[model samples]
Each structure stands twice: as structure tokens, then as C-alpha cells.
Target chain A: MACVVLSLVGISAAPAAEMVRIPAGDYAPPLRAAGEPERVAVAAFLLDERPVTNADFLRFVTAQPKWRRSRIAPVFTDEAYLQHWAGDLELGPLAPPCAPVVRVSWFAARAYARWAGKRLATTAEWELAAAAGFTRADGKNDPELKHAVQQWIAWPVPAILPDAKRARPDFNGVRGLHGLVWEWVEDFSTAMVTGESRGDSGLDRDLFCGAGAVGSRDPGDYAAFMRLALRSSLTARHTTTSLGFRCARDVPEDSSP
Target chain B: MKATAWLCTVLFAAAAMAAPPPMEDCCKEAPPAGPVSARSIYQLDATFCSDTGQCLPLAALRGRPVVLAMFFASCGYACPRLVTDMQAIRGRLPAELRDRAAYVLVSFDPDRDTPAALADYRRQRALDGAWMLLRADSGAVAELAALLGVKYRREPSGNFAHSNLITILNPEGEIVHRREGLGGGLDEAAQAVVAVGKGK
Candidate 1:
């Protein structure tokens, strides 16, 4: 199943219309690694730049009846937390719903994506969309497109973001990955750097510096620290700033099946 | 001898009549070990000895009901508050259950809470016959505390560092639920016991 990045207006826009997709297998990894063979199809769309506003989330809450006045587990007990995420929002003449939403926990983000008939983009898939990489939707490579994209990334983020929806002609299509609010990704089980789960929860004693990734001494493996600290935080815990999410989809099974 | 025997019977009847209602809902775990029809508590088999009374093995409560908790008779703050909490929970139970359940308050301050002290504490709570303030040997108390995951450390200021919590055991000697912090909702706790008692 190809992940569709459609505009809320149902427009599939200019650069995207002209763009050809490279078949899923075209991009090669920089570093050879285990689990590389496992393919995770990712599809993401450009946002209107800022995180989705409170109004956008409110639409989601209203659509999904079960989310209203929810009885989330202990992690969601904080009343203030519930209100912040479930802010009062209605369509406004000037208010923007297409903007990104912030102050969202990884749990909350995952729930919202699931409710919306989509899945979160794994970090690799997200990187592929954001950074210079082969277009894996079709079996083709335009080196000119790849070079131009690399050059644009090398260019410092423009003082003004080129409209994310309108992919720059010099580069392939994607928007708001770098310098935007940190996006929550899937693969919660994988630490960012080492790609391993961390900590001593009863559920993961085997990975508790036991037999797994604990053997690494390089300081770059500090992703474990970030993962464990992130896990300790309550599910509903979120600051009203600087956190958001994008989504992905599994390629159609019939295509492979 | 017949008149004396009659007098002894009368006194025994009076004592039983005046017994305090048992403490219900002590030392329990929730999200029961198996299915979730209705029960919610973790249970344990414990033996509580009154400071001077014989050790009462929890097996006796199997087929009978009981409530259990922790305390140091010498505690000045939350410990006394816990007694009030447990008593409130007891008052809410049906009298039939009230008569069947045993309230076990095992003392953690063994160095100072002797059997005599426990008896005095029981009287203060007006336990009459409803509950027993137990005083196990220091070793026994430690062993009991460890099994329940209750921790207590005496502070220099005389106050104890301990959580105010309650445990509920079913009539079958299994813990059905637990409520932690001084913010326990006892009525909710009672429901936990009844659900377990009925084996739901």
C-alpha cells in the first residue's frame, strides 16, 4: 500500500504530480546491519509548517467517540493533561487546522495515528522522506534529482520555509523534517542510535544490559539513555510545545504477496 | 463449680459481643493473577501473632474471611490514621461479613511494640473482638513485611517513613486487592474483597 500524502483539500499538488517513485528496493543503506532485510514501507505528507494546532486534535477527538472523556490508564490521570490535548476548537475564519499539533506524547501520537487509519513512520522511513534518498515507489533513479536534493539540504534552512506542500523543483518532495518540532516516530521498541530497547522493565529483563546491546562501549550508543528516560515519563505527560508527529503506511500486501 | 462455669460463659459471651469489627481489605493485589470477571487483588498467606496472643495462621481464615494491614502501635501520624481508615472500611461491610472476617494489624515497631503494648493499642482502637493488634517477634515481623512489600524505616524525629496502604484478603486466604497512599477509597476496597469472596 502506497502511503498517500494528500492535501486536506484533496489536491495532490505540482512537484508530487510530476515526481516518479523509485521501487521500494532501490535505496541502499550506508552501513550494513542486521534487520536490514526487514522492509518497512513508509508514506508521509507535508504539514503546513507548524505542529498541528489544538484545533486539529480536537477534530480527531470529536470524530472518535471512544476518545471523549476517556478512561486512560494511570498515566492519563492528570486532568490538566487531558484538557490540554483535548482543547476547545472549531473551524475558524483564520485558525489553521492543517498546522502541526504539539504537546503530544508518543502514546497519544500513536493512538491518534491508529484512529486515523494510518501508522507512524519509522525513523528510517521518515529519514528517507525528509533526507536525500532514492524514490522507492518506482524502480528508477534520477541522479540529477538526488544531487539537487543533497545540495538543498547542504543549503542552510531558508530564513523562510519554502511552502512544504510545494516540493522545491530542484529537489524531490518532502517538508518539515529538520528544524521543525521533534516528531514522534514508531519503532518505540528501537532506541534511536543502537536501534535497541533499553531499561529494566519486568517485560524486558533480557535486554537490561543482559545479553543484548549492552556490550557496546562507544558513546554514540547513548540512544539507550534517551529511550529509558522517555519511557519513565507518564503517557499523558506532554508540554504544550515542540512535539508532533507524521505518519506512514505498510505497502500493499498483494504487491508482495 | 457449676455457678463459676455459668459466670465464665456469660463473660465469654459478653466479650464476643463487644469484639470490634474485623479490618477488611488488607494486603491485596489487583488485576488478579488470572481472568478479570470481577476480582482485583494480590493475596498472601500470613501468620500474625498478638504481642501476647498465639500466632494466628492465615490458613484458618481459608473458608473464613479476613482483612490485614501494617502498623506500629507507637506511630504518631499515618499509622493511627490507617487504623481509622481500616475501621471505616469495616463499618461499611455487611454484618455477616463483619462477623466472619479477621482484622490483622501486625506491628512493625517490634523493638518498642511488645505484646502488652499491642493489647493496649487494641483497646485504644476499641477493637473489642473485631480485630487483633499483633506483635510478632522482630524476625517474624521483618519476614512478614518483606513478603507484603511494605517498607518502614524509623526516623530520628520519631516519625516513620512508610506508605499508608491497605490490603484485602479473600476468605480463601488470597489477597484480592490493595490501595496505596493515605488517599485510599475504602468503599472501593470493600467491593474488591466481596468480589474475591464470591470468587468472581
Candidate 2:
């Protein structure tokens, strides 16, 4: 499967679409239940080469005016959603045109992805893709990558974003995944480190049969744990300065299956 | 000024004529009466298959207030009590008000919680006419879970670790209140249902 930039009507007006083809591979994520398979199979998919920029989102809102900040429903977003934008259509001085857009709620992100005929990457898929380093596809075992992620997590967020493509790309040709904004995963809500169901609730154990064994598989994987924690704490309507998202697409049948 | 006043009067009259009748009686099972609000959960275009083999958009339940929760049929731990808590809350409502409210249990395990499975679970739980056991496709499940703010993950073992939340939605499908955790007092939820049922 080849990843190429396709000019789509609803998503972007830019000359080149930024997408990368991720090959199908086996991923051993940090959060796994005991007795589960050691590796999970991830199907080949298309991912945005860089995070969605303010300009890209501007085009989306321009095409579908209902998604404009002023007109959006309260149910889909919190008060802070798109507050950084100077106006509904304007990116303002703080957000540069090429900077990754922030302060977008999960609902807004999902809608944007839908408008683009793409979908948000699942938590597993995001983790799998982010595991790549400069040289290797599966860098979960790389202490340097893990340390870099931790360092990024500790730093204060920059007031102004530089550019979506400023950071170097990873082995998969995906860029700015780690040292940039936290992404909105498709199944972010499913990161249930803490919620209504617990082993104490006998039925929850039955419902999530092996969940007792499903905690951090590698306690040393602090970066992964932090990401999981942040995701679970979020609501669909909540937005933040450090969170943004890119889009993904399943491989077409003729190309892969 | 005279023409503007006349126009205002005409517009007001049209709006009043278009207005739905006030739901004064908490017990009346009104048909879905108005356009769904932009914020309403019913805005989601998801189809749900009930235990009794009734397949319809979740919006079909818009005519009455609903108490909603998510669980899989085979959950061995907290789900049974979650159902009981739902039952307890429904029981606390006045009989007339009870008839106007719905108790909805949406299964997170759609693969196993088929219509047949949901039906069997409903039968075993002795759910009454006031209750609906529902299953949908995975995409619908994710959307509903996101809207409801209930987190869940299916383990490799086919069980789901889920958050326990009971959400109360008005007849318009707007979430009015939520009770979190396992097996808490249903008083708050019950009160919210009555208030919503009475169009408060």
C-alpha cells in the first residue's frame, strides 16, 4: 500500500495532502491482560504525516459552517473549545497558520475527521505508531525514545506553536507525535484505568473477565502510563492547550485484503 | 414602529401556535413531540437492537425520560448489581411516573450480546415492560459510550472493564443528571427522572 496526499474537497485546500502508509505489524502494548496474546496484530492503515494545522481546520469550518466555534452545540464542546482562535474563521495571532491546532474537543476532532472521510486512530493504533523511533519501527524497548517522551511530558507547553512539520519524522515518516501535542484517540474513553467498574464489583470482573490482569504490563513504561491517565481523565467535550489530533484511514480492500 | 410591533405580534402568535402542549402530568406517555435539539443524545444516528428483537434508532425512545447504563450480559461482577440499582431506582418512582420513564441497558459486548443473548439476559434478570436491553454495532457502542461518558475496554478474555455510570436523560434525550460508581442510593436519579418527566 502506498500513502499519497489526495486533495479532498471537505478537508483541505492545500496543494499536497500529508499522509503516510503504516505497514501491518505486531504490537506489544504496555497495557495488556495476563494470558492474552503477547503481540497484537495491527492492520495496515493510512495516517496523516503531520498533525492537522490551524489552516487545515479553517478549511474544514469554512466548508461546514456548523462546526464554527460560535455555532457549535454545548453538548459537543466545553467553553474552551477553539478559544485560542482569534475568531470563528481567523486563526488569530497566537495560533500560526501552519501550527497544529489545539483546544479542539474530541467531538470536534471526530467531526473534522468524518468531514475529511477519515477517522481518529484508536488508542492501540496510536501507541503502535508512536512506538517507532528514528531508526526502528518498534522502539518500545528503546530507553532513549522513552526518556524523550518523558522529557516532553515534563516540559511546559509552548505558548505559540512553531509549525506542524518542524519536528523530525519517525521511521514511519510520521512527525511530531511525541514532543508535540497529545492526540485525541478514537477510543480515548476506553482507557479505563479508573471508572465505575472494578474487581471489587464482582460483576465488573465477570464483564471484564481478565481485567484483573490488565494493568501496566511494564511498570517502567511511565510515559505510556501517563498518556493512559491523561486520556481517561478527559470527557468528550473537554479541550486543552496541549491536545490535538490527526486522521487515519483503513486500507482499501483492493490494496490490502 | 407600528409595523414592527405588528410583525412581532405575528411572529409571537406563530411561535405560540407551533408550541407543544405542556407536559404537566408526569405519567403521560407522550409521543415524541418536537424537533430534537442539537444537544440531544438522539442526534446520534445509531440503530439499537433490543432484546425483544426491536431494531430502531436510539431516538425512538425520545418520547419518555430514560435511565441509561452500559453493561455486558456475561459480566460476572458489578453488572448484576448495576441492573438491580437501575431496578431499585425505577421502583422508587411513583407508579404513574414510572410508566412514563424507560430503563435502558446498552451492552458494551455487541459480539456476544446479540439479540438472542440480550433477550436471554433480560429474561434471566426479569426485566419488565419498562426496561429495554439493547445491543448495537461497535461504532454505535463507541458513540453511545462517548456521549454517555461511560468508559469501557474489552479485555482479551472477552470481558469488558467498564466505568459504572447511570445517566438520566429528559424526554428530549438531553442528559439531565448522572450517578457514578457501583450500587449507590437511587434517590438522586429517581428525583431527576421525576423532574424531567414533569417537564421541569
Candidate 3:
């Protein structure tokens, strides 16, 4: 048994996954319902090198002083989260300013986008950009962003849906989508259906934490159920240490989704 | 000629004194929030202007007792109960003391709220004449809100993120007491009002 196990273990490391970068262009979700695929307009921007920092969001909050958090209407402070994210050094410069901001509500994120004079990227736009997949030769943040994205934009071949768990957003190209914080999508209602009451069923399940039925086997699936589900898990009604945002710009009329 | 000039001056001074500042029951000289900090007045400034442009400064409501609570006019369930509580409190007041106190309802929904909307909101509540529905253009709202230590936020579902706190202030602008949640009835709030008013 030992000899057999050792021989099986002799299998070499899996080769690095291929990355195919699709060019800057309009794209559609690889998975569609039985009928027509809804084509969303994809505007393009250079992705944030990483999830936005505390300083990035603080800039948004300070500029829109109207958005200053109020304790009475404290929507975003989950006792569980504050205990997890806050550091012990409250009054000092030792605090890490660039650590990702947490505990932001959806409204605040939208307000931040508006303040930035940009909008949150829609799921379709995000998927199209994410899909043209990338594989990193190495794993550094900046180079990873560039290299993985370059591989993603170059993806030429298609794989089956089940294989997509490892595939980048559009996997037709070698683009990378993993290892970053979850991105917010614009199609918020896909998680909700019409006529849902607070407890009846669907997205309005609970005020504090409800499931968004935008269910997906993989994050790459930007279907209505999956999109709705992503919106569901969020608790952003106030400033939390966990919440943050990124801005998406509109492509000139000449651009695509 | 000197006597005539002195008489004219006295008459002009009398007219100036007669034209008092706007709030009659209010305007007692009260100090800023001092050493005796109380919990009921947790979130203080009441600067949200109602649609009619009232700064709705709760601190301005010094001296004459105040029964202050927060409410959103659009609320489907909890709001009417809040009104009923205030009305019941008003019902308990002796007519003379009733005339001595004020009630202000500040809306957190500034985007859709207007002065006309506030007037309609007041009318719907059927609150007694002493209650004033107010709004402000963000700045005064923050000021008055901070004074009262009132906290609130807008939720993803378009409702407000708020706690239920009702405060009763003395004529001296001190928060004598507070009750948390919709459970505080008009009787409870009015009781606090009467207690503080009688002390003054």
C-alpha cells in the first residue's frame, strides 16, 4: 500500500492554468436561459488595482459630509463585524489607512459612487470584463492585475459551464477573477421579485440578513438569481469596517457593455 | 422740546420691546449642554427643516416643557402608534400646561419631504395644535439633530435606520428623561412633560 501510494504521489504539479485576454469590447454572459441573452452595455475602465482602501472611501465620505454617519440611524454597525475588523490602536498613526474598508451599506456605496461622479458597474459589464480570463505566471498584486487581466482579455476558446468554476469571468480569454473581494453589481433587483412582502418569500425575507435568490454555482454566473443573491448577503446601511466600493465610468457612445 | 424728544424716544423703545422674538413660550436663557449629561437626550440637534422652512430647533424650545420624539411620516405601521402616544400625552395635559409645551416631529426622509408634505403629515396625525412638523436644508437638520443626539440613517429598502427614542425636556432645556421604542405612550411622555413643567 505504501509503495502504491508513493507511486501515485509521484504525479507532477498541475501545469499553470491558461489565460486568454479578450480585447476591450462588448461581451455577453456565456450562460443564458433557453431563449435570448439580455445584452448589457459594458463600459470600460482600468480596474482598481485592488479593492478600495479605507482612505479611498474616507475621501468619499468627507467630500459628502451630508453622508456623515449618524448613530441613531446606524444601519451598518453589526456588533459582530465591529469586533472583528477594528484594531486596538484607536488614537494613533499605527492604524493601517489602506486596509479595505468594511461595514458599508449599499446606499452609502451608491452615495460614494455618485460623489465620485461615477457609477457602480452592472453585473453584465463586470462579467464581460471578468470573463476574458487571465492566469498569473506569478501572484503579485499589480503584476497579477495586469498579467491576469491580459491573459483574461486574450481568452479565445470556450469551456463548459461546470468547468467555469475555475474559469475567469468570460473564460473565452485567459483573464483572472479570483482572490479579490467580491464586486458589487448594478442589477440589484434580480435578487427580488415583484409583490414580495417582508416575510412572504423571496428577497424580502428579513430586514437585517436575507438571501438574494440570484443563486449561482459559481461567482462567474451573473444570472438574475446569482446577482440577486449577492445583493442579499450585504448589510450596508451604515459605516462598517468591512464595506467598500469601486467606480465604473460610462463608455462614450462608441463603447459597449 | 427736550421733553417731547424724550417722550418720542420712550415710545419707540416700547415698540421695539413689544416686537418680541418668534418663539414666545421658548427663549428662556438656558446654558449649553452642561455637566449633567443624561441618556434620554442621546442624539440632540433638531435642525431638520420641515417643508415650511422651520429649522425646528428643539434647543430653541427652552423653558416651556417639550415632548420630543422622532418619526417618519411614511411609516406604515410604527408611526401611527407614535402619534397616538403623543396625542394621549396631550390628552392628559391640563389645558394651561398643554399650552405651555411643544411637540416637534422631524422626518429623516429629506429627499422626498417638503414643507407642504409636513403640513399634510401633521394634519394626518391629528396631533394637537401644539405640535410642529419641521424640515431643514441638511445643515440646520444636522445642528438640531446633534443637539438632541438623534441618530438615523436611510436603509437599502428606502426605509430609515433609526432607534425609537422619545425625550421630554424641561423649560431649562435639560433632558429630564427618555423612553426607548414605540412602547412610550403619550401618557408616559406627557407624564415626563408634566413632571418637568411642574418643577419649573
**Highest DockQ: which candidate?**
2
Which lDDT value does model 3 have at A126?
A: 59
Give the Cα error of residue B13 in candidate 2, in Å.
25
Q: How does each model score on lDDT?
A: 0.49, 0.81, 0.49
Model 1: residues with Cα > 4 Å off, grouped in runs: A1-56, A65-86, A90-96, A133-172, A192-240, A253-257, B1-200
Stretches of candidate 3 above 4 Å error?
Answer: A1-52, A57-97, A102-257, B1-47, B55-78, B93-97, B107-113, B121-129, B135-187, B191-200
RMSD in angstroms between candidate 2 and the native structure over all alpha carbons: 7.2
Q: How well does candidate 3 score on lDDT at residue B34?
A: 50
Estimate, for each residue in A1-257, the C-alpha lDDT of model 2 and write its tens digit. 12233335443464234788888877666566666687888888888998898998998887777789998877778898889999999989988988899999888898889878888998778878887886677776666677778889889999998798877788899998888899999988766565433223433553333445665676566777778888867888889999999999888878753
Question: Of models 1 and 3, which has the larger DockQ?
Answer: 3
- Which has the better DockQ: candidate 1, or candidate 2? 2
Best by TM-score: 2
How much DockQ does model 1 earn? Answer: 0.02
lDDT of candidate 1 at residue A194, scale 0 to 100:
29
